[model samples]
Target: MEPLAFSFDQPLFQLASLPITAGHLVAAAALLMALVAIAAGRRARSLRIDERDGQISALLAAQTELQGRIATMAEVFGARQAELNQTLSQRIDGMTHRIGASISEQTKATHENLRRLQERLAVIDSAQNNIQALAKDMAGLQNILSNKQTRGAFGQSRMEAIVADGLPISAYTFQATLPNGARPDCIIRMPNGQPPLVIDAKFPLESWNSMRDAPDADRRQQAAQAFRRDMEVHVRDIASKYLLPGETQETAFLFVPSESIFAEIHEHFEALVQKAHRQRIVIVSPSLLLLSIQVIQAILKDARMREQAHLIQGEVIRLMEDLSRLDERVRKLQGHFAMAQKDVDEILISSNKLTRRGARIETLEMEATAPPGPSEKGERAVDNRMGQLKLRVVDED
Candidate 1:
């Protein structure tokens, strides 16, 4: 038993006017179906293409309107930017001007302050120079006071200066030798040839300095006692050496160079002062010495005035005598003037008498020369009588 073989070439059906086999029919059917499908696809493709063209046109119109709106917005933004730039430039210029003015004012103020500071520095420099000079002077003064001999010279110089300034050169003498050969520091010549006033310039300042520099009270007390003793001894020496009978004054002066030291002695040591007074030793500072010199000067002036009193009186007497002589001469001149005036009066009276006699003679001559008229004889007789009377008047004048 074999199975039947199926083949497309085996004819199973007939077609009009063509060889109709099963294979051919089936092939025809396949071809027809493919053609139908191709037609449907073509129709759908045409419709889709039309739709795409319409969408493209609408999109182009909308893009054109959007571009116009963007251009308008860009123009507005540019105008606003220009206005902002102008405002910013103006504000910057104003700010720059204000900053410049502020800087100028600050510079001026700084210059003024610097000038004032320089002036103050100059003044301070001058004061510093003065202070340095004063310091040097003080150092020199301390050096001079350190040594005993120099210290005595300093005191003596100070005393001499005071005396020289207050008195004439001849009135005071420096280092005058006495009768006993004891030389004193200075001797003021008294008025009217009295004894000279002796002054000693040597003072013991070492004990005073020690007393002042003592740290403890006991040491200060011991120094004070030593100073008092030294002062007493110096006073005794002055009294012994300078106080001379009929040579120097009864009292002698102990010159203290320093005013503060003199004040200290007077304030702290009353007993020492009293003892010196009893010893006829007078302690004198520069001011006191000057005062005494002035007193001596006044006394000298008074003595000079008294000594020249007789000369002044003689001058006054001579002036009075000269005045009396002048008065007598003036009286003689007045008497001569009176006699001259009387002589002038007598000459004036004689001139008036001569003028009257000349006028009467002229009148008589004119009457005699005139011619006689109707009563010639009587007229002639009257004229002769008048002529005789005129002649008698002239003789009397």
Candidate 2:
């Protein structure tokens, strides 16, 4: 049933599957699986390479940015740190120098304060010594004033000193005896045309001191009454003694214990004061003493002025007499001057007239001495070639 051309030499195996064998099939299948495995391995390797590259690039970029940022931070930090160090160093140095300067200044100030304190202490010591000296002087003064007469004398001296400071001593005088044969303490001249005034100093010391130092009330009362009586008596006595008829009146002065005493006199002893007034006795106290002194000073000044005027009256009269004589001499000299003026006028007139005569004579002499020409001599001469030309104009009527 087979084809007759088939040769017996062909292998039965070849004829059964010509190119395809079991081994071939297995080899092809193995080859194909090997290629797929190789391709997958290459692709995985490429993808891993690409991912590595991208991660590497991102890391590189981040590294570069970090480097730059680190550099900038380093620069800024270094600069700030340097500046902080500089500022701190300057502050430390300044503080140290200031400490040294302050110590020096404090030492100097302490020394100066010590010196000033020493000077103040010395001044205080000196002032204390001066104050002690003043205290001793005051004690001596108090002792001196304890005596009534001494106190009165002190007052008088003070008043006199004040007067001497402001005015001359010649302006004042004291202890003038009135016409009543009683000597007053002082007298003052009045201004213009007023009367003179007198002053008397009185002190009922024994009675007043008795009252002041009395230990018992009754004794004090008795002493006071006695002192009052004594004062009244003195008031009348002063009026009688100092108040003369023409020179002074009953309006004389009586000095009392104090301003308080004077005021008390006006209070409780109003009647006595009235009586004193009727007797023309004015009572003054220490407070009123200045006014009295001023009055007296004015009077003394006026009196001195009047006395000086009286003394200069003679000189004034002499001066006036000399002035009258001078006036008379001036009149005589004026008369002499008038006569000299008249003589000058007469001389001037005579000299003028003589001068006029002399001028007329000189004119006559000059006219005679003038040279005369031929025509003037009553003849005319002409040269041989020249003719004398005379022109006569007849008047036509």
Candidate 3:
């Protein structure tokens, strides 16, 4: 085969019936080359388009997976948020309950404390009022005791109260006149024919009070001497006036009416006490007077009881004799009742026998009246007459 030649300057087709030159052939060849290049470029463009489509498919698949993951994450987040909300709500409710209970307890305790405080305050106010009333009473008592006459009256009243409380009205007499035309403050009558006891209530308190209230030792000594002289004089007067041989007891009581005065006398005036004792005079304070009065009352009671003892014994003996006689009479009466019962029983027995005889007589008479043989009729009549005779005998008995 001949060598195949390639023509670079040849036209592949005629355009318009004109012979194309080499330059034209060259241009056509260039054009043809350009066309071939353009076709290749178009193929490359198709390849690039296919590659882009594949990348876009892969991206779409990735996007779909990412979307599914986001949806799952959102669901989980929603569930977790709901759980946290519920937990928080539960904790808040518990805290509210605890706080409410605590507040209620605290309020109750506070109210209790307030009530106790109010009660204490009321008690304190009552105590304050009592203290004030006591102070007023003390002031009144001080005023009453300031004057000599009122103080004497107060002491006398106290003595009277003690006497009235302890002794019966008939046992004591106030302001009794003695046989010597001297009047004693009080006289206590003794039972069992004993002599009466005299009590003098007037006392010399001025000197004693002066001695107690003296400003100096010298003044106190002077006041004490005066007190002793005044007490001795009073005691002598009481011993002379109240101690009547037949009318009053040998010992007379000089009532001081004040315990303080009595204590002072005993503490400072021993010689005066001895003098009064020699004169058969007893110096007594209010408490000592009360005790002496009680002793006298007891003695009086015992004496009265002793005086009545014989009469009581006589009465008891008579009562015992009467009880013995009553017992004997009751025994005699019981014996008489027994005898009467026996007689009544005997009479009832006789009455029963009479009734039986009368019933037999009635039966015999009825039989006699009935039709019978002559002998039988004679026997029945005889039995009826015999039964009548027995009933008459029983009636006599």
Q: lDDT: which candidate is best? A: 1
Clashing pairs in 1: none
lDDT of 1 by residue, 1-397 (tens): 8999888898776667556777887898998888878877787777777777777777777777777777777787788788888888889889889888888998998999999999999989989998999899889888988887888899999999999998889898998899999999999999898999999999998888889999999999999999999999999888989999999999999999989999988999988999999998999999899899999999989988899999989999999999999999998898888898888898888888778777766876676555666887978787788878777986795
Tens-digit lDDT track of model 3 for 1-397? 9999757466556668976666787887899999999999998888888888888888888888888888888889889989989999999999999998999998999999999999999999999999899999879866866777776666667767777788899988887899999988888888877888888777776677788889999999999889888888898889889898998999988878777778867887888988999999988887888898789889878878887999999999999999999999999999999999999999999999889878877876675464445797778777786687678667766
Give lDDT for model 1: 0.88
- Give the Cα lDDT of each candidate: 0.88, 0.71, 0.83
Q: Please report the TM-score between candidate 3 and the true structure.
A: 0.52
Off by over 4 Å in 3: 1-141, 318-397
| Model 1, TM vs. native | 0.54
RMSD of each: 17.9, 15.5, 13.1
Give the lowest summed-lDDT range of ten residues in model 3: 364-373
lDDT of 2 by residue, 1-397 (tens): 9877644344435445574555665676899999999999899989988998998999999999999999999999999999999999999999989998999999999999999999999999999999999999889877755787886665456544544454455544467777778876656555555656665656565676687789999998898789779878988788777877777643766655456656866776687778888888877775566676676677667767887996789889999999999999999999999999999999999898778756755664554343445573332322211221111111210
TM-score for all models, in order of appearance:
0.54, 0.43, 0.52
Candidate closer to the true structure by lDDT (higher is better), 2 or 3: 3
TM-score-sorted candidate list, best first: 1, 3, 2
Off by over 4 Å in 1: 1-130, 325-397
